[model samples]
Target: MDYNLMREFADSWGLVAMALFFVGAIAFALRPGSRKMADEAAQIPLEDGRS
Candidate 1:
């Protein structure tokens, strides 16, 4: 295996990949379905009378 090639590739593309992943995560988190799911999860205990 070539360590130099691996390091260069990682340095070049790793940041882009990480940035894209972060943006995607943020977008998904702000989506309506995500909020709805969160709201439903918050109501579970209330519905079950466990609160």
Candidate 2:
């Protein structure tokens, strides 16, 4: 419950960890063959329950 301690952690290792996670997420989203999955997801609402 100490604001100062939390702030210090976030200013160092926490920041690095979050940055790495963001980069990894970006890499995964941009990987090859992702477009087809993204397009299918984008069409879900228009399927009209035709499944």
RMSD in angstroms, all models? 3.2, 1.7
In model 1, the runs with Cα more than 4 Å from the true position are 42-51
Per-model TM against the reference: 0.68, 0.82
In the range 1-27, model 1's lDDT, one tens digit per residue, is: 599989988898988899999999999
Q: How far in Å is the alpha carbon of 30 misplaced in model 1? A: 0.4
lDDT to native, each model: 0.88, 0.94
**Candidate 2 weakest ten by summed lDDT:** 42-51
Candidate with maximal TM-score: 2
lDDT for 39 in candidate 1 is 90
Clashing pairs in 2: none
